[model samples]
Target: MLLLLGLGAWAEKAPAETSRPALTVSVQQVNFVDMERTLSATGNIRPWQDASVSVQTSGLRLKEVFADVGDIVQAGQLLAKFDDTIIRAEIEQTRAAIIQAQASLEQATQNAKRIRRIMGSGAVSQQEADQVLATEKINQAQLSSAQAALVGQEQRLAYTRLLAPYDGVVSAKSAVLGAVYNPGQELFHLIVQNKLQWEASVSSRHLSALEPGTKVLMHVREDLFAEGTVRQQSPALNEQTRQAIVYVDIVPGAQVKAGMFVQGDFKLGTRKVIAVPRQALVLRDGFYYVFVLENNNRVALRKIEIGQSLPNGVEVLAGLVSGEIIVVKGARFLEDGDMVRVALAASETAAGAGSVMSFARAGR
Candidate 1:
């Protein structure tokens, strides 16, 4: 009978140890704070101005190509050259015609002068003097025509040597050596002025908050960031998407390139909020919950509403108070209505003892 009593006592003692708290957890008090509210959007980098470089004068073989795709050029810089042999020969021919016309005019002028002197003395006939004057006028007209032709040929010769119209980076090229091309053919495409901007579109509802000079932060990559400002906003919105575009001017000298897709945020305003560590929140059945410490060292699982996710923590929109203590660590192994041992640091323990001792003296 004594042995039976001992076994029963041991059984009751085992249940007591099993009923102790499952684990110790750290907790933090909720904080009330203010944070910036931002609007995010996606966009692409594009050149502020772009141009299609084409051949103005053609019908000749491409003799040499000096600039290719990805080449940077300045205004009036040589980009390519055509076979100038044909145009150069035409220019020389025009020059010779001008010289011949000049000689003819000079001879005709001398003849008219001689005729004028003889006509008064009856040595030249009236008809002959009139003819000499008319010849002189004809030769003068011929000289003018020849000069105009020479100017046109000279202009065409200049066109044979292709030059860049503005400072830009070559984005495309079609020029091939020893290949004949016609007028208006695109030989190279340039990104004019080498300037880039982000073309981003946002919902029409958020348009009023964004304006010129608003601060923007562009996410170029995981670790890289670029700062920018809103240059302008489109006055109209798309009928289908109901979105408006905004041009953002990013700072130069970044690793960003044209045609790269990027995402960014626009700082609009600020708002007051209450938040807690992200680890303190638990998600189950698509609902978020936090372990709130109650009286008697017990924990109660409380369902909470979550708002925007911040950089360090999450904003709690409802179901929590500013001064409430919630579990910070070791919450994954906990459940509702579980008795817990509040684990306090050395300093916290000292502070708690001091507060209690002061309260006891007041009660006395």
Candidate 2:
């Protein structure tokens, strides 16, 4: 009797559940999204053109400097100079060699003339005169060699002074007056003017939404209010993060500096379509649907097709239209065919304001 009574009680409860009214939910009309789909990434801000400056020769003291960090410089502008005392001395020695070679050449020419006259008069063997002529020709070649060496040495010595490679701002300085820079020592860093790029990463799944020349609005992550475009997308995705790098081109007018890390949004492109608050979309049995109320105050289940998603809402591609009443809040409680009471969004003003205030405080 006790087991039979327990079964009867469970059956009675089942009837109550079945007889209960359907779930109630607020509904929102399908709306179009004004903004396009965009992705965000966080890499770094860098100069579009950055250059490392270095010297080629070693054991030379930086004697003087005319430019420093933050200084605007033009191409070939003198930035610094090194001591050339030893180099000047070497140049002088090379000049002396050239003079000596020329003198020897003159002496050889006179000897050759004497030998030719002797050969014609039969005062010397023709073979001896030929040897003298060859010696004179050798002297002439040696003079030419010496002159070329002097020119090369002078040019190499002139390289001791450093000059700006392009019109840019000096971002770093290493070599100073009296500092000896080793061969290939880095001296200064230059950032070309009006050149900047933003580095950010986006999800690999959203790769289809990304492309070169896509417009992006980038700003510092901490302060998203400040905002730049998708300049380029990396061909390969990051294996660990499943994200890809994107570079945003920033023009000169924007108030941003290279190396200042920032965040930005990308617009995939704009489309006129259906959309609803994410809270309103529900999933059951792996199917997505929304709860709505009919003229009879009965809740209805409406399946929908979703498009691009945004922070505020999801784009509903189908099963809804503008000017149609739909649930915006309290969607989780209602079920299809259930009687539901309609509520106005205006009634939630105080609650929304309070939430906004709380969020603002948390941000601070």
Candidate 3:
């Protein structure tokens, strides 16, 4: 009879041991991170340096253009050509005038010499010598005028063959084959210097945190990316928008072009973050809670101090630790002292996953 009673008691204890809830669980070891707080804004990539080439002189139709839009050109490379018929004619005419002026100057010079000699002999009047000197002056003035005309023609001729101002790619083209353009007109836009800049904006409230050499990340569309440094910042925020402008210089990067739009986190430094993942948080009674797994895999209903909710996760300022696993996939049905499972490893969570959260184990 005693043996039967002992067996019955042992049978009851066995059910208690085997009655523990079976939970599929995952685990992770958490770590503390020192990271920069990135401020993000949308802006454009522009040339760090751009020069607008224009026609300085007006002229007739040209033969053809030697360079086209999007053409890579070097310094002094021929870009376009113009008809030089009028300039050539002008140059020839000026040359002829110079020859005539030279002959006249020679004649007047000899006349003055002859008159001076005769005056010493009392054979010629002083007025005659004076007239000869005036003729010489007139010849000199004529020569100067002809020389100036020839110089002007030469300059016009040089303008016919347009050249790239520097080593750059042609971004735009306005001049075409045999087209005549007026003064101050654009020809070709060049950007091949491969210099690009990113413009970032900061709100008035966060302007004080921005600094020179503050690091930033830029996400160019189509998977093309470029690294740019903060080169300039606006002195004052705009009154209407209340935002400050930041200029970032892009390093030579793959597939990054001038004037392409990009957006990303820019502010670089550490700030306080209240962070948590989507699944671990439960909305109950208009507040957020987590089924925190304790040391021995038991769960407790814990109230979390949250700041902001994000797309991927939430920020938990005061309710978690670095190395605790909170129920990620299924925690909505958990109660105090209930057995729960952590579906994902805390250590395996990526930096972008969300806030770090700790779980408490429940015991019966």
Give residue 197's error in model 2 in angstroms: 2.4
**Which model, 1 or 3, shows the larger lDDT?**
1
Per-residue error for 66 in candidate 3, Å, reads 1.7
RMSD vs true structure, all candidates = 6.9, 9.0, 6.7
Backbone clash total, candidate 1: 0
Q: How high is the lDDT of residue 162 in model 3?
A: 75
What lDDT, from 0 to 1, does candidate 2 have? Answer: 0.73
Query: lDDT per prediction?
Result: 0.84, 0.73, 0.72
TM-scores vs. true structure, each candidate = 0.78, 0.69, 0.77
* Local error of candidate 2 at residue 351 (angstroms): 26
Steric clashes per prediction? 0, 21, 23
How well is each residue in 240-337 modelled by candidate 2, as lDDT tens digits? 98888877777556767677877677767765666788888878888788876567766688998887776688877788777665665666666677
287-312 in candidate 1: lDDT tens per residue? 99999988766789999999999887
Kindly indicate the candidate among 1 and 2 with the higher lDDT: 1
**After superposition, candidate 3 runs with Cα above 4 Å error:** 1-31, 34-36, 117-122, 205-210, 267-278, 284-287, 294-298, 305-315, 322-325, 336-364
Scored by TM-score, the top model is 1
Better of 1 and 3 by TM-score: 1
By lDDT, who's the top model here?
1
Sliding window of 10 residues with minimal summed lDDT for model 2: 355-364
